[model samples]
Structures are given as C-alpha cells and as structure tokens.
Target: MSAAEVSVRRRRGSFGRLFASEVHLVFGRRRNQVGLLVLFGLVTMLGVALKVSAMRHPGDRGGDLFSLVAGNGVFLGFAGLTIEIALFLPLAVSVLAGDAVAGEANLGTLRYLLVAPVGRGRLLVVKACALGVGALTGAVLVALAGVLVGVLLFGAGPLITLSGSQIGLGDGLLRLLLAALYVAVGLAALGMIGLFISTLTEQPIAATVATAMVSTLLWILDAVPQLDWLHPWLLVDRWSAFIDLLRDPVFTDRMVTGLWVDIAYGAVFLFAAWLRFRVKDITS
Candidate 1:
C-alpha cells in the first residue's frame, strides 16, 4: 500500500478508536442501559399523563400549555410541572453525572487513562461534551414528549400563556423550544457539579447524592424570602424562571440573564473538574 494511504488509514483508525472509547465510557455498560430505559419510560409516562389531562379538560382555556412539563414532569395543582421537574430532573442529572469521573476512579481506569499520555484538559472536555449532550437530549426529550402529548390530546388551538394570554400555537411552541434551551443549559451545570464531585471521590453514589443535595439545598434556601440577598446568585432560584419563556409580552431579557448564569456556572465547574483531575491520584 502507498504511504499516503497507510497514513490515512492510521488516522482513521485512531479516530475510530477514540470514538469507541467515548461510547464505552457512555453506554457500554448495564447501568447506563438501565438509565436509558428508565428515562424513556419516564418520558412515556409523562406524555401519556399530559395527553390524558388534555383529553379530560378538552376545552379548558387560558392556561399555560408550556406548564404541562417542567422539562421532566410533576403532578401539581397550580404549577405542578415545575415541582415535578425540580424533583426528578435533578435526580436524573445526579444519577448520570455523579458517576462520570468517580466511576472511572473507582474502576481504576482514570489512572490508566492519565498514564496513557492523554491531556487531562482534553479528557475533561470530552467528558463534558458527552454529559452536555446527555443533558440536552434529556431536556429536549421531555419537552418534546409534553408537546406531543399536549398537541395530540387537545387538537390544534391557541396556546395559552402563563400570563393567561393567548398566542398562535406555533409561536407558543417556539417559546417552549427557548425554554428547553435554558433548561438544558441549567441541567448541564448539574452535570458539571456531578463531574466536579466525581473528581473529589471514587464513590459514585456519594458524588451523585452530593450533587442532588447541593441542588436541593440551594433550592430550599431560595424559597425563603428572607434570603433575598443570595436568591439572585442561586441557580436553584431561577431554575424554573425559564417558564418566562412562554409568557405573553415575552420576557426574553430575564431568560437571557438566566441562560448566562447557567452557562457561567457550567464553565466554572468544568474548569474545576479539569484542574482537579490533573492533580487527582486515581489509584485507590
């Protein structure tokens, strides 16, 4: 074979190897498989429930169609969707993300990877990409599930906003997409938190629990009106402010602020993970 062809083949082989590694790192195991199944089940359940509700309420008017999902789900009276997402989405993030680095550390693979000459920063970046994709995909799935069930059950009609205003159904959907974007961004931060914790310990459960706890605690704190000073800084506080995405007279400004805040936190956690990973002694 010509040298040029051999070189091309070698490069292609290397790319394939890396791609395989990433896949193995993601879903080549039972836990991840179970996770995928569970997530899908949740989507189906929520979708069916929303569809049923729409069927039951058929002609109800002047309510937020977007509220049917928290990008995950919840059964609430006023804004149960927010409650449902608040509880479940974090759990999902915790489960998938908590194991990210810690799982490698526990299995003694992190040391193996570090010793192989791969840059720590690059590894972190790759892992972050995987987790980011997972989070975004999950968010979009839940949103789409809700929208699908909603549309199917209710038939085509004006989309009622949270503010009790009506909008063209298509425009309402665009707002939902915007909400999914911010919510996805926020959830990615949760993934980074899990990754950061993973770097600190080899116990995936501990790291995952810590990620969930931190999120829950912040949310609790944010709920207290007395903690006004810290509220704006709490990612927990504004988690559902993305609901503004579907409001009439549209509140894009606040949504943009929330997006930036989430993006900033995601960057910080990923940076911390990279730095800590470099110094981490993966050999247990």
Candidate 2:
C-alpha cells in the first residue's frame, strides 16, 4: 500500500481501538456495574410481583397484569419498562453520562489526552458514544431480565396490544425491541445534557449530582397539573411515548415527535459542550 493508504489504515485502526477502549472503561466501572445490577434486581422483583398477581387474581378480569402486560407473556417486558422509564433507567444513564468528561478531567487525564493524538472533538465523540452505549445497555438488560422472568413465570403466547389487537409472538417481541430502542434514544438526550454538564465542571460528583437533580426536577415539572403548556417541550415529556410502540397501529405521531425532541436536546447540548470545551482551560 502507498504511504497515504498506510496512514489512513493506521488512523482507522487507532479510532477503532479508542472506541473499544472507551466502551470497556464505561462498562467496567463499578458504578455502571452497580447501576445495571440494580435495574436487573428491580425487574426481577417486579416479575415476582407480577407472577403473584397473576396467580392470586387469575379470575380477575381487569388488573395491572392486563393493562401492563397486555395479557401476553412478552408484554411483561413492557410492564418492566413502564416502571423503569420513570426513574430507574434515567438514573443509570445520568451516572455514566455525567462522569464521561468530568471524571477524566478530575483524574487529571483530560489535559494529557488533549495533548496526545486525541483531538478534543474526537474525545468528546468517544465519550458521548460510550455514554450512549452504557445507557442502551442498561435498557437492554432490563428488557432481557423482564422477558426471561416473564417467560418462565407467565409463559410466552400471542401478544395482546392495547388497542385490542392480537399480534404474533414474533411481532410482539419486535415491538418490544422497538420500544426499548425508542427509550434508549430518548434517554440519550439526558446523556447529552449530562455530557454538557460534565464539561462545565472538573468534579465528576458534582456533575453526576447535578444531572440527577435536573432529571428529578424535570420529573417534578412534568407532574405539575399547571405545567400542561410546558409538557410538550419538556425533556421527559415524550419519554413514555415508547408505549405507542406497543399499540396495534403503532402510533407514529408521538414517537416521531419524541425522536425529534430528543434530537433537538442532544444537538443543543452537544453544541454547548463543544463550544465550552473548545476554549476552556484544562489545568486539572
């Protein structure tokens, strides 16, 4: 290969290695491991409760099992998701995203990394990607645990959607996957917001706490009856839009709006992080 070809290959190899390293670091952290374990534990506990409900109230026509699980075994994943999206998963995402840049800066590694072959832009991209993967991994684990327990306890069968439509098991699973994907995408905006906050401070703990507080505040704001006008524009407003995926017709209106909302939040925060990191002094 020519010198140019060799250079291109080397650069690609390095970028790939960098990404892999970031992923490893993100997942290997004790906090991330604990976060994942907590999600699994929550799902498992919920599965047990659901199983008990199904047993004792087997004759009951209407209950949480029907509304949440939709009278299908696979819909149990949806039930787990319903409980998780409210707080559990968002907390996990915040942890990784908040620590992404600030952690490195706190450890006094950010300055050296910038001075090294890693460009500031590349570093930010890597951190953001790692944070995204961490968030998505949490979502996947919750879904997997929910399905495994649900299948063992409830048994897999036809999926009954919210609109009284019956779908095949395969289609149900597909919808569940889409729902999880949508959730991951939605939480990614939170990750971006945390990433921006991480850039603003050298203390990782401060960033993490700030992100969590912001998320809590958003949840509180979303709950206020008088805040109806702000609901559409709030970050957490469209998070539950994933529920539409479980519907028979697969309502795209809220899903599309949520996607765009997530994109807008991510784009704005990412730009802010980039702008701040571009000129900010890194003495630590």
Candidate 3:
C-alpha cells in the first residue's frame, strides 16, 4: 500500500522478531530447562506419594485440600499449585526476571544491544513480556503435570468441594485452569519487582537472590500474628486465594483483591524499572 503503511508493517515485524529472540534467550538456556524439569519432577513426586499414601491408609486424611486428592484426581492440581505458590513458582520467576537485564550486562552485551536501533523502553518492555511468558509457562506446566500424574495414579471423576458438594469433571478442570492463571498473575507481578532489581545490579545471581528474598520476607511478615493488620497489603498475602475456587459458591472476593494487588505491584515496579533504565549509563 502507501509508504507509511509499509513502515508500520516493518516496525511490527521488528518487534515480533525481538520478542521471539527474547523468548528463545530465556527458555533456550540449559539452566532454565533444568529448572522447569525440577518443577515438574517435584509435582509428579507429590502425586505419586499421595497415591501410595491412599493405598496404605485408605481411610486416613492428609490435610484440608490434600485429603480430597485420593478420592478425586483434580485436587492434585490444586494441591500442587498451593505448594508451588509458597516458594517454587516464585523462585522460577526470580531466575528469569532477575536475569532480564543484569545477565546481559554481565555478559558485556548490554552496550551492544543499546547500540542497535531499538529504544531502551521497547527493549525493557520486551524483556518484561518475556518474563511474564516464562512465569506463565512454569505455572501452567506444574498444574498440568499434577493433573496428568494424579489422573493416571488415582483416576479422574467428579471433584468433591470443600463444602461437601460435588462438581463435574468439566467444571473442575476449568477451576484448575483458573487457579493456574491466578497464580501466574501473582508470579508476573513478582517478576516485575525482579526486573526493577535487575536494573540496579550487574550480578544476575545477586539480583535473583534479592528478588527471591523479597518474596520470602513478605511471607515471613505475613505469617506474624501482630502483622495481621498489615497482611492485606503484602504481595504474598493472598497467594493461596486460589483455594477459594474449590468452594461450592466460589469465593471471588479474595481472588479479586489479590488480582488488584498484583496489578498495583506490577505497575509500580515496572515503572520504577523503566525510570531507572531510562537514565542509567551503559558502561559495559
């Protein structure tokens, strides 16, 4: 068509290429692959253990959510997610987000990337989006692996809700997907915080550790009885809100609050990352 239209198409193509390259850089690394494998392995092991426990003690119950796993395979996914959101999932996010900027700088490639035609803001956005993709991928994999293992070991059917109600397989699977998405949103918000930390340091390891510590610290603060007043504001406070999805009526209040909290955290930290990177000198 017109010259302007051609230029617009070219720009879109360039951005798509850049984003694809970033995704490759994040997932193509051997370490990231191993991290994902570890996550899957852990979830699978949990499912197997639950199966053995059910065989040994058919009448015994484990815990609130876990107790349902032996009877209905769908609960394994929920239980796996609960265990993951406590630490493993956030650690996965930290690894990717912390390396988004600091890893490139450590390799002395940050300056070279800046020399290209791409603006710093655009590059940062691409990096953030890539981190989000990585986070979602990890969360979804855990849930899926849990479901597969649980179904094979225990068999799938209707899910027993916490309120002594039952839901069909279709509706239960849908809730599992929603729980995975909810957890992914929280991990994405944590990734943004890691992105901001990555902007401040050249050591990717340090950034990774620091970002993980932020989550751990929040969890510790949230666990304190005296801090109950401040619990509502902590990023990690409502991480387990996905459990509400298993209820009969499906409690939306906590999940909605958690979603907004995640959004606010993501917006604030992403802006901080942008503002810092906008002015920082590229010495590498």
Candidate 4:
C-alpha cells in the first residue's frame, strides 16, 4: 500500500474512534436511560388523565384535535420545556456534565488521555459538546412525548394562540421545530454551569446536585413578585419569554430582547467554564 493511503486510513480511524466514544459514553449511561424512561411514564399518566377528562366533559369547547395537540395545549402547558427544564433537564445535564471531568479524574483515566498529546482546551471542548448533546436529546424526547399525549387527548386541527392568532398545520409544525431548537440553546448554558461546577470537586454527585439546586432556586427567586427587577437578567426566567411566539402580533421587540439575553448568558457561562478549566490542575 502507498504511504498516502495509510495516512488517509489513519485519519479516518481517528474520527470514527472519537465519534464512537461519544455515542457510547452518552447512551451507555444508566442514568440517562433511566431518566428518559421516567419521563415517558409521566407523559403516559398525563395522557390517560386528559383522555378521561375529555370523555367526562363532552360539552367543553376548543380547537380541533390537531390544534389542541400542537397549539393551545403546547403553549398553555408551558411545562413542555419551561417546567421540565426547571425540574428535570438540569438534573440530567448535571449528571452528564458533572461527570465529564470529575468522573474521569476519579477513575484516574483522565491522566492517560491528557498524556496522549491532546491539549487541555481541546479535551474540554469535546467533553462539553458531548454533554450538551446528551442534554438536548433528553429535552427533545420529553417534548415529543408531551406533544403526542396532548394530541391523543385533544384532536388535530389548526392551532389558535392566546393572542387570537391562528397558525396553519404546517406553520405550527415548523414552530414546534423552532421551539425545540430554542430549548437546546437554553439548556446549553446550564450544561456549562454543570461542567464548571464539576471541575471544582472530585465527587460527581456534588457537582450535579449543586447545578440543579442553584439554577432552580434562582429561577424561583426570579418568579418572586418582589424580585421583578431582577427577572430580566435571570438565566432561567428568560426561557419562558419564547411564549411571545404565541402572541397574536408576534411581538418581535420582546422576543428579540429575550433571545439576546439567552445569547449573552450562553457566552457568559461558557467563558466562566473555560476560565476555570484553564486554571484547574488535573496533573495532581
């Protein structure tokens, strides 16, 4: 074989190795899988309750099945991503991100990987990206399950928002897609916070639990009436701002501001994580 052919094969193998490692590390995780199962069960229970209620109240009025599933309930059930992220996504992201370095550090395998000539920053980047992907996956699964449950309980039809605006079937579907993408962005910051917390402790549980507690407590504080002044700046409070999509006029002003706030937080959290990472010493 020519020398060029051998080099080409070597690079291909490296890429595959990296990709496979990420997949295995994510899916092989017992916590990730268990968390998903629990979410699915919750959705099933909610769907059954909805179905029973609808049967009991035939006099109720609202949009058709399609609209009910994809539109009204999705928005009204802001819990779709909003409440889920507050109560659960953080826990899932924390488990993965919290273990990113600390898990390896605890097991003594991080040292060998570092000695393989890879830069610390590069390793951190790969690990962070992997954890973020895991988090996004969990969020999407919950969204899909919730939408499905909502549809079965209600009928499918055009979606009507509280703003009195109507979105056609196609538009509603696309909006759902956008909503999913936005959710990933929101969770990405939390993942970084977890990653940063992980670097400070050798115990994986400490980092994971701390990230969930800190984010949730701050989110509650942002909701407190007396703390209205701090709402705009709170990382968790801004996520619900996407509900502007449901507005009749689709308020671009507030939407744009909310998005920018999310971007700013993403930047701030990532920078903070990286800063701590650069200073952390794993050589010990």
Judging by TM-score against the true structure, name the best candidate. Answer: 3
Q: Pick the candidate with the highest lDDT.
A: 3
When 1 and 3 are scored with TM-score, the better candidate is: 3
lDDT of 1 by residue, 176-271 (tens): 676666777888888887888878989888988998898888788988999999988887667787677657788777767777788888888888
C-alpha lDDT of candidate 4 relative to the true structure? 0.69
Model 1 TM-score is: 0.80
Q: Candidate 4 lDDT, tens digit per residue, 57-158?
A: 755757533234333444323345554767777677778877787787787777887786556766777777787687678767766776676665554567
Q: Pairs clashing in candidate 3? A: none
TM-score-superior candidate, 1 or 4:
4
Q: Which candidate do you rate higher for TM-score, 2 or 4?
A: 2
Model 1 misplacement above 4 A? 1-20, 43-84, 163-165
* Least accurate 10 contiguous residues by lDDT in model 2: 63-72
TM-score of each: 0.80, 0.94, 0.97, 0.83
* Each model's backbone clash number: 2, 0, 0, 6
Report the backbone clash tally of model 1. Answer: 2
Overlapping backbone residue pairs in candidate 4 total 6
Put down candidate 2 lDDT per residue, 129-232, tens digits, no spaces. Answer: 88788778877777788788788877888876778788888888888888888889878888899999999998988898888888889989999999899999
Using TM-score as the yardstick, the better of models 1 and 2 is 2
Off-target runs (Cα >4 Å) in candidate 3 are none
Q: What does candidate 2 score on TM?
A: 0.94
Candidate 4, residue 171: how far the Cα is off, in Å? 1.2
